[model samples]
Target: MERRSNKADKFKYLQPVDRAAIALMLVLIVLIGLLIWNGDRTAPRVRNFSWQNQQVGAEDTSFTLNFNRPMDHASVEANLQIDPLLPGKFSWAGRRMAYTLTAPVFYGTNYKVQLQGAKDKSKTESGKENEKLIDPFYGQFSTRDRAFVYIGVEPQEKGRLILYNVTQQKKTVLTPADMAVNDFKIYPEGRKILFSAADWLSQKPGVFEQQLYTVTTGINPLSPGKPETKPEAAGKINLVLDSKNFQNMKFDLSPDGQAIIVQRVNRNKPGEFGLWVIKPGAPPQPLENQPGGDFLITADSGAVAVAQGQGIAILPMTPKAKPLDFLAQYAKVFSFSKDGASAAMLKFNTNYTRSLFLVTNQGVQKELFKTTGSILDAQFDPRSDTLYCLITRLQKGEQDQDQEQPLLATVDLKKAKMTPILALPNQRDIQMSLSQDGLALLFDQLVTEKKLPKTGALTTNDGQAIVNSLLWLLPITPPTEGSKTQQQQPQQLPLPGFRPSWLP
Candidate 1:
């Protein structure tokens, strides 16, 4: 009787405590379940952004956004806004979203991107209670300044490569007094420049003693509008190819800065002329055994286009490699698109006229327009749908004298439409360069005289005695309705230089 009573008392106390613990556990479980089910009501946030206070370039065509939670693609795109109205396409990959620009961004510009009023994936899919909006996101970015380098025509800084900042009034001399810079090409990154130079004090001809070199531009495109902070690496020159055994004629730096294509003629044997390629830290290698005319390296740096026997041969960059493609109708390639998919080429027809053709790598050749005068140069816009050509047309002036007038024209590749942007009367042998953003054009107007017999004076690239040279900046704008000419006027820069080229 005593044992039964003790066991009953213990069971009675344990049963009450066990019931209380079970009830508490059930309450906790229910609370956790409710929290888990309502988690979709939490606000969505942008975890990371690609262009947050970053400096971008033409190569940076796309940006991405990583979200903390899955987002509704349609709502996010509809809520996103970019300043200056950059046109692009959007793509989604799980929690990440990307925006790819259809055209290149403008240089020396400040941009802002904003996003708001977007919903989470769960709230968007299901009509659930307590729906929440995503947190507002904002981003900022800037581009590099508009800058160029040219040969100084002034007597004090003659034969020197000078860098002039168009955005900021800053100038830096890039060559020493002993070296005379001839021609130069900027690297794609704008960090270095490849140029040809000669000893200024040597009694021999500058052409015979020409050597190849690279100089640091000391430009930091990342920090736009601040030339004062970017002052390092100026006037730092390195020898690339020496002219001890051969004479270097025409040379081109690859767009990727990996290879250099140069035309050379052997010193000992005048008949031996060919093309040579120099890689990074490697010796010069012969590309072909014969000579070519007006050669240029492709944008991809995989091949070179050479004008050969009334045709253009696209030869691979390797040694002794055969031609990759050949076009028998075009005489020369003026410039290539940024993607390396299209090119602006020149064709010399038998009817005493030249035609500008838009040639694609897919073997599509469309003639943009035909001109009866000479085609000086051509450049493709960033969109690859417009071509800017510098050509000449015959005009009668002053007692019916035939004059070659230079005209700056833009051709729409899709519509085959030609519009005359600017006409330079009494201008001959002019040089032009297009800006990276396709917003402006740089050209030089030179006043020249006949060269003296044997004077140690300065002369332009075309052997003209340069009296004065002016640099003009023309803003590229569309023609107004019912008007045939652009209303924007050309602004003359306060720099005295010739053969001006924008830093890439």
Candidate 2:
């Protein structure tokens, strides 16, 4: 039998170059093993922070922290700290930790985050704990400035969209001169404004001929204080829906800024009133449901709440879709929370009294309070536990509609307490808006005149006649324990405008 060559005898015939190459490969494997072992024993560090030096928006509800090594979830969560007290939940995936906010952060606030004593999840080969502490990390972020948009009532800027930067003390006109803006809604990003306008120079400049258009706000959401640079000029105008066959009525811009919900009536058939959606790159389409009164596009931008007969109907935006849910108790839906969890609504009682209710998605209807006067509008604070309402209270011994005084009130949802903030006597058809940070309130007070202006009669969004309008800003301060409720006063903004609204 032939003698079999042993493994050592076969390798003895190898060249010197090949033997050296094998030795180099063995050394590389040992080096790699040593490197991995050292890496596991080293201290963990934050490799990336999602909101590092970034400016966030309302839609930015969560941030992420990436680590260089696997980390102990409990230790990381316990050591994570955010300044100014932002309530949120922590989640982990491998070495990444995510913090999701329970609610939108207050606008115009600078937030700081720090993590010092987080431990890693590494272990020794013998199954012994060998966790390493994470390196100290600090990060910061900021929100956009406090800003608002209004319809300029001044003679030179009449019927124009005016953007006022409350933080910077700057004002800029966003619309052209020849077009008369009817009504407008700003996009959630604050980069564009959707409005209805008509040719003011034309003799037939009527509301029936109004057309939907969008104009550039030039307010960059990323770098808020800096103007947006683009190929098109700032304040560029683009026509969206025209009033060729249907007249555009009250309209709302979707929170995502992808679509517009506008009430329109057929030009030929005045009785045919319905809601139409004008989406970008698509023609206007009508919802298959019946025409309803005073509608609002929901926060999710997927449905709409319309005031139908004796109740409010929540209908999906899709054509031919059935109603998502019909709230037979609520007669009017005013506003929804940022997360779309709660809505401020109105219920009409048989005794002619209207009750404001905080309707939640969790099948809970909380009755805030009842008022004999009408509830013009209500807005939920970013915190969702506070509500600001613009309501009318019947004056003593007066039942006339004009005798109703507008009162700005705040309701603490948790404590079930209602506080009157401001009393606007002789202010009719007044409009109020709450800031994103829940720190300021804006409302317009119109000054009536015996005679109309020489240019023409200026009217509000509600079609009320007015000579001039005054914008007022009221700062909202949290009530402290043992502190008296002092009457808060609003400061006039020196802006001659109506329908003042805070930018998103």
Instruction: Report how far off residue 255 is in candidate 1 (Å).
Output: 1.5
TM-score of 1: 0.87
> In model 1, what is the error at residue 265, expressed in angstroms?
1.1
Instruction: Kindly list the per-residue Cα lDDT of model 1 for residues 60-97, writing each as its tens digit.
Output: 88999999888888899999999977889999999999
> lDDT for each of the candidates?
0.82, 0.81
Residue 347, model 1: lDDT of 95
Predicted candidate 1, C-alpha RMSD: 4.9
Model 2: runs farther than 4 Å from truth?
1-16, 32-39, 81-85, 125-128, 201-207, 223-233, 396-402, 450-455, 478-488
Weakest 10 consecutive residues of candidate 2 by summed lDDT: 224-233
Clash tally for model 2:
0
- lDDT, candidate 2, 339-381, per-residue tens: 8998999999999999999889998899998988888898987
